[model samples]
Target: MKKIIYTMILAAGVFSTTACVDELDQTPHTEITSGDVYTSAANYKSVLAKVYASYVIAGQEKGGGNKDIATTSGYDYMRCYFNMQECGTDEMASTWLEGDKVKDISYLTWDASDPWVSDTYYLIYQTIDYANEFLRNATDDNISKFSDSDRALIKQYRAEARFLRALSYYHAMDLYRNIPFVTEKDEVGSFTPPRYTSSQIFDYIESELKDIDGDLLDRSEAEYGRATKGAAWTLLAKMYLNAEIYTGKARYSDCITYCNKVIGDGYSLEGDYSKLFNADNQKRTNEIIFPLSVDATHTVSWGATTYIVCGEVDGNSSENPLTYGVKSAWSMFRLRGELTSLFASGDKRAMFYTKGQSQYLDTGIDTQTNGYLMTKYRNLLDNDSVASNTASYGASIDFPMFRLADVYLMYAESVVRGGDGGSIGTALGYINKLRERAYGSTDGDVKTTDLTKNFILDERARELYMEGTRRTDLIRYGKFTTSDYLWQWKGGVKDGKAVNSKYNYYPIPQTELTANPNLHNDNY
Candidate 1:
C-alpha cells in the first residue's frame, strides 16, 4: 500500500502542476485545466487518490516544498487539528515557549487571528476544494473514454470523493458552526458561497452520507486509509451523538441507530490496548475502522505520527529514542494531572510516566517536569521493533481516526442520555468489553447500576486519551468552558478558571471574513 501511495504522490504532482490554484482567489488559473490531466481511467483514479492524499501529505510535493495551505508554518492538517482539539483541554499541554500560540489554546484566550484556527479553516476547505474538483471532472459524460468496468470503478471513486467532502464539511460544522458552503455544482469563477447555519450543514452532511452509503465498499473491502460503510456509519453516529449541540435538537436515538450499525459490522476490540498505537497498527484492521496511514520511508512528513511520537518525549530521559523509533526527542507534550487521576490503581490504560514529574502542574515554572509524561502513543512495532528507516522527522505509526471501541463508548453515552430504542444492558455490555481489555480481566468491569453520564465522560478519557478527542468530548459534556470541571494549568492559572463561553466555537478567521462578505462571525 505504501507503493500505491507513492504512485499517488507522482499523480498528485501531475494533478497539482496542471490544475492547482490559490484557494482564496475563487477563480481557476487559466494556465492549465483538468482537461489536460483527466485523459484516462488511471488519470481519473490518480486524481481521486490525490483527494485522499490531501489529508496525509501537507504539500504539492513531499517534505515541505509546496504547501496546500500557507500559514505561520506549512500547517499540516492533522497536526494543526490535533493542537486545536487536544491542547486546550485536560488531556495534554505543551512546554515549548518560542512562537507557541498553542498556550492561547490552553489558556482559552484565542481569537480569530490564531494561526491554528485559521489553518484548520483553510485545511478543511482546501481538502473540500480538491474533492469537488475531482467530482466535477469525473462525471459519467466525461469518463466515456473508459470501459464498463472502468466506469464502475469511477463511480466508486465519485462516491469516495463525496464522502471525503462530507467529512471535511463535518469538521467545519463541528468547529466553526456557520460556514460558507460550496460544492461541485457551484461555479468556480469569482464566487462567494453564502453561509449555511450549523443545522443546515448538519442536514447536508447527513443527506450526502446516506446518498453514498451503498456506493462505498464494505469494511472488509476498504483498502488501508480509505472510506467504507463503517467509516460513514461511525461519522454519522458521531454527528448524531452531538446533534443536540449542533442543532439544539436531541437525537440520541439516531446516534444509537448508527452506532449499532457499526457495532454489528463484525468490528471487535483489540485485545491489547497499547498495540493499536504501535508502528504496525495497519495489521490491526479488525478494530480500526478508519486510519490516517503514515510511513517512515514512503510517507515521511513532519506532521502525522512523527509529530505525535516525538512531541511526547523528554529532553533528558534515559529511554532510548530508537526504542520509540525516532532519532531524537522533542520534549514537548505532557499530560495534565486531571488525566492521570482518572485511572484506577491497576487500569492498564494508565500508561503515564511519573518518575520525575509532578501530577500537579506549577504554572509559574512550566518546564518539562511540571506534569506527567504520557507513554500511550509510541513508535515501536507490536514485536517491540522500530522501522529500519526511522529518522528524527518521520515515524511509521498510523493514527486511528475511528475505531470500534469509540463506537461502543458513544453507544453507551447515548443510552445514558435518555435516547430511546437502546437497552441499558447492551450499553453496559459494550462498556465492560473495553474495561475488560483495559484491565486484562473482568475485575474492572462495571455493573449495570454503575452506568451514568458522568462515568462515561471519565471512561472516555481513560480509554481514548492523546488520540485527538479530549477537547471536543469535554465541550459535548458542558465542562469545557465552565469552571465546573477545572484541570491544572487550565486558562493559564494554577487553579483553573472559567473562560468566556465564546471560546466554545473558535471565531471565524478574520482573513476569511475580510475576503468574503457573505461570511460573518455571528456566533462569537
Candidate 2:
C-alpha cells in the first residue's frame, strides 16, 4: 500500500520555526506520528469516533475535572430541562444563591488549576487535525475499500468534522472571547497567533460553516448523527441571532432568514417533547440536529451518561437506570423562578424535573440533598432488553446539540428584532407548531404571539432549559446580568446579578494571561 501524505498548509504559522525561534532554537516535539494507528483507514475512523467521544462525560467523580464540565449543566449555567431540587437554597453552589458561589469566576485561574480548560481547547483542535488529515490523505484505494455510498459517507464525516470545529470555536468564543482561530491541522500548538476579536471569531465560524454547508446531506443517514444542512443552518441562525452581542451589529433579519430555511427544510416538532430526550427514543422525532448518534440497539455510547446515579442500599437512587452517581459534583442548573412559572399550569414539561427533590435516591450519597433531578436526560431503571423492548439501549442515551424547537424560538426572536410581517408570521408559525405538539393540540391558549425578546427568552427557557445554550442565551440577550424586576438576575442571585457589560464576556484565564502577556482581561 502506498503511503498517503496529508499535509495541511496553514497561514497561521502554527508549527513554523519563525514564530518559536525566540523561545528556543531546539527542535519541537511532534505529538503524533505515522505509527500503525495514524496510517490506516479503520484506525482513522476510530480516531474520529474518539473525537466525538469527548461529548461523553469523562469525569464522574468530584475530584476529577468532570465536575467542571458538568457544572455547565448546573443552575449557575445552562438549565434547559431544569431540575429544581438542584437549585434549592440548601446547595451553596446553586446560581440562585448570592455571593461568589455561582459567580462568573469559572475562567479565572488560581495559579495551578487543573489544565482542563487548556486541555479542552487543545483536544478539540487535535480532533480537527485528525479529521483534516484523514480527509486530505484518503486515496482511491483507501476509499475503494468501501462502496461508493460509504465513500460519500466518509465525505459526510469530513463535513461533520468541519461542523465540530465550528461548534468548538463557537463555544470557545462564548467562554473565552479572546481566542486564536485556527483552520488547519498545522495550526496546532501555536500560541502566538493574535486572538481574534469576538466579531472575527463569529466571522470565522460563519465562513467555515458556509464552506462545508453544500457538502452536508439534506437528511441524515441511519446511525449518522453528524451535522446536516439543517443543523448548519440552525447554528448559523443562532450565530446571527447573537450578531448584536458578538459583533455589535444587528443581523436579526439574517437570523430570521436562516431560521426559515431550517424550518422549511422538512424538520418539525416531534409529537411528544418527552421523546426528544427519552433513552429509547434515540433519533426520536423532533431532532433537527444533535451531537450523539444512536446505534442499532438504541444505546448512545457518547451521550451524557454522567447524569446517572447508582441505586443506594437505602433504596434511594436517581431517576436514571444506569445508577452511576452524579459523576461530577456538578449538578443540573434549575430554571429561574421566572422561567419555571412560564409553563401553563398543566404543562408536561413542568414534570421534566423533580424540583426540591432529595438527592439521596439511587445516588450513594446520604448527607448531600436538595435541588431538582434532571429528568430530561434521566432514564427508567431496569428497562426491558432491546430484543424484548421497542427501545432498549440497556444504558446509553444520545444528546441533542440542536433541535427544531430552537429554530422556532430563534425565528421568533429574529422577527421581533426585524419588525417585519414575514418575520412575525414565520416566528409564530414555528412557535405554534411547537405549542400544538407540546400540548398535544393547539388549544386556544396554547400558542401566543406576544413575541418579544423577553417572551422568546421565556419560550427558550421553557423549551431549551438544560440543553447547554441557556447561559449563552442569557448573556447575549442582556438577561445574564439583568438586575431589573423584568428577567433580572438581582443582587440576591449569583455574582450581584446586576446587568453589567462585563458580565457579557467571561474573564481571560489567569494562566493564559501569564503565558501571553499581550492578552487582556475582559474587565480591563
TM-scores for all candidates: the values are: 0.94, 0.71
Question: Which tens-of-lDDT digit does each residue in 434-509 have in candidate 1?
Answer: 9999988889999988999899999999989988778789889999999889877677788888888878888778
| Per-residue lDDT of model 2, residues 349-458, tens digit only | 66434434543222211122433444554343225232112122223444577887887787787777763434566567777776666667667233444767787777
Q: What is the C-alpha RMSD of each candidate to the true structure, in Å?
A: 2.7, 8.4
Overall local distance difference test of candidate 2 = 0.50
Clashing residue pairs, backbone N/CA/C < 3 A, model 1: none
lDDT of 1: 0.79
Model 1: residues with Cα > 4 Å off, grouped in runs: 1-6, 9-32, 388-393
The local lDDT score (0 to 100) that residue 334 gets in candidate 1 is: 82
> Model 2 reaches what TM-score against the true structure?
0.71
